[model samples]
Target chain A: MLAALAFVAGWPLARTIWFGFTDASLGSLADAEWVGFANYLEWFDYGDGEGEWFGLLADAAWWEAVRNTLFFALVTVSIETALGMVVALVLNARFPLRGLVRAGVLVPWAIPTIVSAKMWAWMLNDQFGIINDLGVRLGLLAAPVAWVASADTALIAVMIVDIWKTTPFMALLILAGLQMIPEDIYEAARIDGVNPLLVFWKVTLPLVAPAILVAIVFRALDALRVFDIVYVLTPNNASTTTMSVFAQQNLFQFDQFAYGSAASTALFLVIGLVTLGYLRLARLDLGN
Target chain B: MRRAVGLAKRIGFWALVALILFVSLFPFYYAILTSLETGTAIFEPNYFPEVFDLRNYAQVLGQGSFPRNVLNSILVATATVAISLFLGVTAAFALARIPFRGRKLLLLTVLSVSMFPQIAVLAGLFEMMRFLGLYNTLGSLILSYLIFTLPFTVWVLTTFMRDLPIEIEEAAIVDGAGPWDIVRRVFLPLMGPALAATGLLAFIQAWNEFLFALTFVASNETRTVPVAIALISGASSQETPWGPIMAASVIVTAPLIVLVMIFQRRIAAGLTTGGVKG
Candidate 1:
């Protein structure tokens, strides 16, 4: 099993990084020459002491993908964290049919990303979408807005779906943290006649902060590599294109294997930083 | 004034509950409504089902390759789950019960393997699959999907194995059973619930994966349901068959919803174990 994991996880990642340094194309992968970071950046000399740097790092679209991915990760993680706290707090309370609501929250989480993409694509349809219908009826919009198709709202649309899908998961993780705090803490606060809101701000938030941090980091790592939803939600919308989507399009659609490999390697490094942080956090928690 | 504030709070709480339920489920409900509409009515904006029509379902089923894709998904998911469970059980056994050097490091390594993003190894896996002549075949999918499922299964089952009382294994050993025999005879019997939960989770992961299925395979016959629906609706909006697409989406999601409901607790057993979708 260990060996299988090494082969599955370690070997491929190593080779992918190695391939990023080569001039390999999908057509003739075997005989490709080592380009030594040429795929990432190449110095092109036009003589007369003039030279230009070229490669993935120099590409505007690649930078856009990076910015978009970072933006998505930052914004979605923030919104999802706040909303997830609310959901967790609500579920923590003893209410009638709380279990039902909890289960319902998982509904979005349960649906497959591609299926949700399609479902949302239909719902966000400008002409006949129920969202447009409701929006117009509620006077929220003067006209039907193309949610996924329009460049202005495409990434927002993707972020909205992601939050809808992942907030429940975040809530559950936070709830676990909330459950870990001994009941006596809250009981003592109640006995003191402290405001419920103050109790939450002073006690609950501090206690659950670690778990919420872990959840945010995990969800951020996921959002950074956002692909299927973006790919399926708005196929060719460049404004909403993320790092994973850009890498995939280059790898398969555009057939720039080496360039795509470079993009993948860069993304791996970015995510690797977060994974290391997570590992450190996990270690600290375990040490306790 | 105090009573009024209390009443307002009550109303606010119920309203929040209603909002949660609506946000959670309205898309799927609207999908069902849309799938049941036929002809011109299918394109018309309506919150409720205006017509009860089975034509979309029939069309999706009759799309020739849709059923084949579904079968492909089933076969791939089943094969992946079966193999993952088989390997996971033995791995969990060793990791849980066996005393060995570097065990702790190995266990941590196993746990971290589950966190690998699919894109990190896409290019290399594509090359390997093509070299093995498994590209565009279901074999490619099963092979790549193990990168996700195997780690998860092994980790989940291993956690479960550690919590089981050690006396059972000791008794098996006293009965003169070998390690493999004890595993098969003693541990396997007790692993029913853990095996099922891990198997179901692995199955869902394999079923919902898209990047590998999309990148590795090209033919309609070999494409999974997700990619098939994606290709069908990938065309421009006017020609995008929303009704058939909705029907297909519902078909793929129904089984998952049912499984999730049944195994909800099993899913929450670990961190992000219920991540059947990405």
Candidate 2:
């Protein structure tokens, strides 16, 4: 089993790391010569402030993708975490038809990201989209807005779709954490006549913080690597291109295999460091 | 006065519940409604199902390589689930029941493997597929999907195996049941729920995976549901075939929705345990 995982995952990871150092291309993977630090240098080169910056670090397009990815991750994670907490709190309450609602919430999450992106892309169509019609009807917009087409609103459009599809996952995780809190703690708070809001702030939030943090880290990592939604919703649009999208475009479309590998290697390092930092901070033990 | 305040709260809460339900389900409901509308009906912004046209569904299923893509999705997802479960069960037994050094490290390694960005491995994996002559084939997808699916299966199954009462295992052991015998004859029977939950989750992951399917498979017939739906275009590049797209989306999502509804409890348990406990 370990060998299978190593071959499928580990070996490829090692190959990518190795390729990041060499001038490997799609045409010549085996015959690629050693070019230690050249790919990295080219990626980080400042270009002496001349005309037309080169390398990923100096490239405006790469920076745009990085900014879009981080902004998307930050906004979506915040909104989803807040909304997920609310939904989990609501669902945690005893209510009629709760199971049905729970099942309903999972529908969006269960749907494929590509499918959801397509559905939203159609719904956000400027001309005959229901969203525009409703926005007009509600006096939200004077006319139809091209939600995914225009650069101004494309990131927001992607974020909305992401929040819709993934908030359920966050809610489900927090709901599990909520269910774990002992009933007596709430009962005690009620007997003490504490403010309901205060009770939630003091008792519930602290107890569920671990689970919420875990969910946030997971979602953040996922959003950092956002690809399918951006790719399908706004293909080749620099305004919404994420790190993964940029890497994929370069790797496959441009066939700059070594340069793309460098980008991907950098991404892998960032994700790896962040994950390690989070694990260290959270002190989560998988063996337990 | 108190009664009035309580009444207002109840009304507000129910309203919120209604809003949540609408937000959660309205898109799919609209997709279904749109799928049932023909030619010009879809152009108009109609909320409810005005027309009962089955042509869109017929069109998506009847034309092109959609049915073939759906078959490919099913085959790949089922194969992934079966293989992941088989590997996960045996690995979980070793990691869960066996007392050995470096077990923790091994388990952590499995956990971290799932978290690697797919892009990080794409170039290498693509090269690998070509080298093995598996590019554009279903074999590439099924194999690449293991990078994501196996870790979760192993971790979740290991957690489930740990929670089982140790007394039964000891009893079986006293009767001379070896590790393989114990895992197969004894524990596997009791692990039906865990197996089902993990298998379903793995199936969903494989079905929804896009990057690998998009990159690895080039032929139209080998495309999975996600790639096929994504690449679905109209007769001309000017316009998108929304009606057929919605129809196909509905078809692909229906099975998942049904499965989720049926196994909500188990799925929730699996996710929470995997997330929180891990």
The candidate scoring highest on TM-score is 2
B92-186 in candidate 2: lDDT tens per residue?
Answer: 99999889999999998998887889999998898899999999999999999999999999999999999999999899989999888998899
Q: What is the Cα-based lDDT of residue A188 in candidate 1?
A: 99
Worst 10 residues of 1 chain B by lDDT: B269-278
* lDDT per residue (tens digit) for residues A128-226 in model 1: 788888999999999999898788999999998888888988988888788889999999999999999999899999899888877877788788888
Query: How many backbone clashes are present in model 1?
Result: 0
What is each candidate's fraction of native interface contacts (fnat)?
A: 0.60, 0.76
TM-score of chain B of each: 0.92, 0.97
Please give the distance, in angstroms, between residue B52's alpha carbon in candidate 1 and its true position after superposition. 0.5
Q: List the residue pairs that clash in candidate 2.
A: none
**Each model's TM-score?**
0.95, 0.96
Q: Write the per-residue lDDT of candidate 2 for residues A1-288, one digit (tens) a residue.
A: 899999899888888888888888888999877888776655444568644435656667777878898899999999999999999999999998999999998889899999999989988999988899999999999999999999899999999999999999999999999999999999999999999999999999999988899899888888888899999999988899998998999888998888888888988987888788877877754334
lDDT of 2 at B234: 85
DockQ per candidate, 2 decimals: 0.64, 0.66
